[model samples]
Target: MTNHWAHPTAIIDEGASIGEGTKVWHFSHISPKTIIGEQCSLGQNVYVASNVTIGNSVKIQNNVSVYEGVILEDFVFCGPSMVFTNVRTPRSAFPRNTSEDYRPTVVKRGASIGANATVVCGVTIGEWAFVAAGAVVNRDVPAYSLVAGVPAKGMGWVCECGSTLTFRDQKSVCHDCDREYERNQDIVRKTKDV
Candidate 1:
């Protein structure tokens, strides 16, 4: 038997793969073909669809539905009621033939998606990117970027420590952690410590 712990009300299919130390709370549904890594937490009413892949130490908050064709890497945080859509143009009359018809959405390592945010399909959220609450992300987000507002334009940079960055002459120093970053146009990457 798997070492993962789930509440009695949770429905975990026999074909699902849950790693050791993972905790799935009440009313969650883990579908077949899904693989969740170690130390992950699925809060109440969460739904992980078939074939979804989640890496280690991920935190999915309450009422979130992780649809098919989505991959979440290690250290990712998905906030409450966040939305993920697989189809770009979903029509009720013309149903999708299979899960392969769905577009892939990837949230990279150390990324955090805030509550009620919407991640559109086929978009790659770079490592350490932060999506603010209620934002609508329709495009790719760069690493160490902080995006907010409608359509989720890159507002500024964010440190790996999860603090907002202030740049001077395309060079930013994270006051909270003293990590340095170089910004070229819209792309930001950690360079060193200040």
Candidate 2:
């Protein structure tokens, strides 16, 4: 509460909940009903819409707009200019109010969304997942997966340390952390016997 910082140019609407040590930089707009946790950083020109929930230690870079129905878990990194869509198919003239029309986007704990990436709605990005720059994610991303390309396909698995997995005979090891992961049908799960 006392440690939070909001620039003079930032507009935090009434009823917005910001946690201690959080910082809102210039030209940022935090909408009413938005809940942001401690140690979070909202960079310049950022817009967090009402009903969005941003968890502790989340770093949202400049020029990003987090629309309603997006939930960012603890330690999540939203890179500069990344996009999150709430409605799967949106039309300005034809508005849909049903709950099914506005799908929620969940960014799991420790996930990192790279700069300029686009996350389509209704997809659950798993814990520690990495989305590469400029990728368009249209489906659920598994935990520890490194996804890239348009419409984002799982190219490989990544460690919790954010290093790529080196595969040998259906098993992969993390070079940085020396952790082991088992690959199964495009999903990688951590193994205990590393």
Error of 1 at 53 (Å): 0.4
Please provide, for model 2 over 1-194, each residue's C-alpha lDDT reduced to its tens digit, 9 standing for 90 to 100: 35689999999999999999999999999999999999999999999988899999999999999988899999999999999999987998999666457899999999999999999999999988999999999999999889999989988878888998877777887777788888777767788534
CA-RMSD of model 1: 1.2
Model 1 spans with C-alpha error above 4 angstroms:
none
Q: Output the number of the lDDT-best candidate.
A: 1
Q: Residue 123 in candidate 1 has what lDDT?
A: 100
Instruction: List runs of model 2 lying over 4 Å from the truth.
Output: 97-100, 192-194
Against the reference, the lDDT scores of all candidates come to 0.95, 0.91
lDDT of 1 by residue, 1-194 (tens): 77999999999998999999999999999999999999999999999999899999999999999999999999999999999999999999999858879999999999999999999999999999999999999999999889998999988889988999999999988888899999899888889955
TM-score of model 2 vs. true structure = 0.91
